[model samples]
Target: MTITYQINTPLTAKQAADIFISSGIKRPVEDLARIGRMLEHADILVTAWDGDQPVGLARAITDYAYCCYLSDLAVCREYQQQGIGKKLIATLQEHLGEESMLLLLAAPSAIDYYPQIGFEKLTSAFLIPRSK
Candidate 1:
């Protein structure tokens, strides 16, 4: 499959939700408005496309100078293990400044995957649980 990557591409909430569901990412896909807001507020968004279909996505909130929080990374199940996720991350990194540090909270299923892609495993991170 010939995959094409795009940065800051316009994506409808439905398209985002579809990939979330297909990728097995635990997102509120039923809530289109919330999904739209997520897209609206992200400072950076990278997507992997197969022709007209979006097969993967990465969204981040960053200062583009100091730090970048990689808020979401998802690859459709059918596209998983094909390096689409890695390419999406690489595409995002290309947009970041040399001084920027990338960070992300991995889903339980993805804990091992990130390290394989060069993300350091950290024990010092903390989080306040979100109330849905």
Candidate 2:
């Protein structure tokens, strides 16, 4: 399958929600308003499309210079074992260029996946749990 990857692609809440759910990335999909705002403010959004269908999405918040937080990386369940996820990331890095450092808080299940794609483990990270 030839997936077309695009940077800063505009997506509807339904499109993003469907991708997040199918990819098992646990987001508040039922709340379209919140999801809309999330997508509205993101500085970077990379998406993979199978013609008219969205197969993957990677959303991020960045300054376009020093640091970028890849908040979400999701590929449709059927499309998961392929290189789509890695391609989404590589596209994001390409947009941010070499000087920017890309980071993400991986799902527990994905912790092992990142390192295989050149992400180094970080010991100095911390987060306050999201209360929802």
Best by TM-score: 1
Q: Where does model 2 exceed 4 Å of error?
A: none
Model 2: lDDT equals 0.94
Clashing pairs in 2: none
lDDT for residue 61 in candidate 2, whole number 0-100: 96
> In model 1, where is the ten-residue run with the lowest total lDDT?
90-99
Model 1 lDDT tens row, 89-117 = 98899899678999999999999999999
TM-score, every prediction = 0.98, 0.97
On residues 38-111, what C-alpha lDDT tens digit does candidate 2 reach at each position? 99999989999999899999999998879999999999999999999999999999999988999889889999
Candidate 2: C-alpha RMSD after superposition = 0.8
